[model samples]
Target: REMLVAEIEKRLPAWEKKTHLKCNGWQTKIMQNKWGSCNPAGKLWFNLHLAHTPIRCLDYVILHELLHLKVRHHNKDYIALLDKYMPFWQEVRKELNDFVLMPMK
Candidate 1:
């Protein structure tokens, strides 16, 4: 849990610096389906299972949710943001999708 939080914290500054978007706050929890989610208030939530995945997966999910603060939907603007920030996001997303979410201890 702490590892996931630390990972988010570590990547946030650079993302904020590049995009000028601030993440109000975030929480890690045992989500059954989604890897991450962003609220309208700019707060983010990451699936606790992410910590067991690759760092790239966590990074991808972080950027995915962060971009939601700007685009709100998986529209052109959101796709553009993902392309702009992480050019290889689709590949990383594919990798993430391959992992079956296991119940965390």
Candidate 2:
């Protein structure tokens, strides 16, 4: 998860150089009912299933959370920010969140 976050962060600047958000850290674990979560304090958590998702989907998630630094809630401003950075974010989000993967037994 840390590595994935790092990779995403590394690509963030190039995505929208105007946005000044930064990522403090991220964690990925076997969360039963969440795709990801971000807090006002800047912590990020992702479901373990994301490890297998396409890179674009991962980028959408990272950008979504990073936007929280500027907009705390999922309001118009937040959605607009995401739309600006990731035009297809909503679609990618639906695809990524709805994805279900079985863990190794």
Candidate 3:
């Protein structure tokens, strides 16, 4: 968890500086249908399953939610912002979606 937070902090500086956005905190937990979620209040959470995926995938999820802090919906403006920050975000998103995690049972 500490490592993940560190990575988030590292990746966040430029975005935060550029957009003046801030994230209060984050955590990880088992999620059935989503890799992450963010609220208007700036709190973020990641699916515990992300621990097993590639670091870039985790970064992708974090960035996705962080962008939500600025853009409330997946509209054109939101997508343009994502493209500006993470140019290949669509490819990264596809990789994340294509990844298969075994069922907990």
Candidate 4:
């Protein structure tokens, strides 16, 4: 958990410069059907499965939800935000889908 936070913090400047959004905090826990989730209030959660993913892929998920702090939902604004910060995000997403471990719901 601490290591993940450090990685996220290291990437924060890039996210801020590109998306101009802030993330309140982050946590890792078991989740069945989610890679990550975000709330309008700036909280973000990640599936513990991410601990097994490549660092770049984890960054993509973290950045994806952090961008949601500025634009909720997978609408144009959100996609645009992701595009600006992570051009290769779709590739990462695909890799995540292929490799993610599902937890009991």
Candidate 4 — which residues are off by over 4 angstroms? 1-5
Better of 1 and 3 by lDDT: 1
- Model 1 bad stretches (over 4 Å): none
Predictions ranked by lDDT, top down? Answer: 1, 3, 4, 2
On lDDT, the candidate that comes out on top is 1
The CA lDDT at 85 in model 2 is: 75
lDDT of 3 by residue, 1-105 (tens): 666666666766665676677788777777888999997678888877776778888877877888899888999999998888789999999999997765544
Write one digit per residue (lDDT tens) for candidate 2, span 17-85: 557776566666677666678877787776666767887887777677678778888999998888787
Q: Evaluate candidate 1 by giving its C-alpha RMSD to the native, one decimal.
A: 1.0
* lDDT tens per residue, model 4, 1-105: 677667766776576666667778767778888888987678888877777778988888878888778777899988887887788889989998898576644
lDDT score, residue 105, model 4? 45
